[model samples]
Target: MESNENEFNPQQPNEHRPEQSAYGQPDQHVTNPSFKSKLELTIFSIEHLREIAKWSKFLAIIGFVGIGLNVLGLGFFFLLAPNMSPFAAEGLNIFAGFAGFIGFVFIMALYFLPILWLYRFGDNLKKAIDMNNSAELESAFGFLKKHYKYVGILIICFLVLYGLIIVFSMLGGLFAAMGTL
Candidate 1:
């Protein structure tokens, strides 16, 4: 009986397999596909992600405070509007009062808008860290860098608007004084 020796050995290492082409010989027919050539891009680094997570609570707290302040401002305006001569004598018409309230609410939202992005950034960073996607982790850091400016803008706008409101209130007081005179 003749014994055949060509059968592949299961115990042999993959490197020694017959199917492997010549050493250092690139596959000419296999042009590199652009998609396959590169690894997936992620947003954040592990260190940055950990930092974000560490500070997430602080950001959340700041957001909560901002939201609370806005709510207080809204309540103050609503409570005072009815006592003012403009709305009081006019009976605070439903449509106009509602419109004004909406506008105030919109402005308040703008003031607290950074809180929204901060919350989102923290959440996304946490998720990326959990998923172990370094690229995504870096992306989250990039997002924070890009949007922090917007947050700053929101803060500045809120301060400016608040200043305007105070100026108008002072003017109103002056008019009341003139009326008394």
Candidate 2:
């Protein structure tokens, strides 16, 4: 049997068809869905994102708990250092302990920024999906972008720091060898 031109057929490609999406623009459905466009990600993939965000938010809260516990440890050690006798306290080097605590806290604060971003991303994503709010959805994705950007910059900073440490050590070694001669 011959198919009629007016009848819609799955086997036939219809390029001229104008299908409306949420807006009046033609619906752009991905034939090869290996990669999704932003529109597809925001609209169609929200359920997946919500699930991911739920888990991520849980983990970030757990991390915050871990940091709080670490603060207790810092306090414990800090308190222990000062209780020693005056001479012993000097030998114990409470200042070093204090410095270590400060440094640890500074690092933790740096890490907390990314965790905050992830938490915001997760919370906003969950809320946006529930409310079907575009503004909230955009905020969720913006936090995700900032999380990535901050992590990338942190990695670059660490690499540069490692490079500087290596160069300084090598120079120190060369200076020691010359001084020995």
Candidate 3:
């Protein structure tokens, strides 16, 4: 009779089996899949998570309020752009306001997603802690991941933009120097 690799041997329980792992059968693709989480959340960790949830919620609310105020300010700015004091040059008032409006809108659009993700993370974290539900905990973690991912991507974009600006500035300066010479 041929011995099956999948069958657990009760007689040789202490012997290391290539097919078995600490968490049952080993994944074929993952070599040495024995890393089990020993992290049993102590009181200190739970308390810290609670504090983080609270702070996240607080910051998210403040962000929302700031966004709301900025929106209101933009509306007023648009309404009063034409009535503003005349600039030294003609049509500069509307152009300045429009430029400001575009910049603000861009900033707000960038700001919104992370704030929303942060809020969801906080809300879900609170629910997870209160209800002790793994599903809610998973959801909270997902939101946190999304928030970080968005911020990371935004940071990369800003870095690229900064690099482009520096390159353009250097080129412009070189051109200006060449023109003078």
Backbone clash count, each prediction separately: 11, 0, 0
Q: Report every candidate's CA lDDT.
A: 0.61, 0.73, 0.77
Model 1 TM-score, 2 decimals: 0.45
RMSD of 2: 11.0
The candidate maximizing lDDT is 3
- Per-residue C-alpha lDDT of model 2 across residues 48-143, encoded as one tens digit per residue: 887988997998898888888887787576656555424344676577667667888888888898888889889988987887765566678778
After superposition, which runs of candidate 2 have C-alpha atoms over 4 Å from their true positions? 1-38, 41-44, 81-92
Model 1 global lDDT (CA atoms, 0 to 1): 0.61
Cα deviation of 138 in candidate 1 (Å)? Answer: 2.1
- Show the colliding residue pairs in model 3: none
How much is 81 displaced in model 2, in angstroms?
4.3
Q: In terms of lDDT, which candidate is stronger, 2 or 3?
A: 3
Please say which candidate is ahead in lDDT: 1 or 3: 3
Best candidate (score: TM-score) = 3
**Residues 32-106, candidate 3, lDDT per residue (tens digit)?**
445444556778887898999999999999999999899778856754755662451566767776777778878
In candidate 3, which residue ranges exceed 4 Å CA deviation?
A: 1-36, 83-88
lDDT of 3 at 97: 67
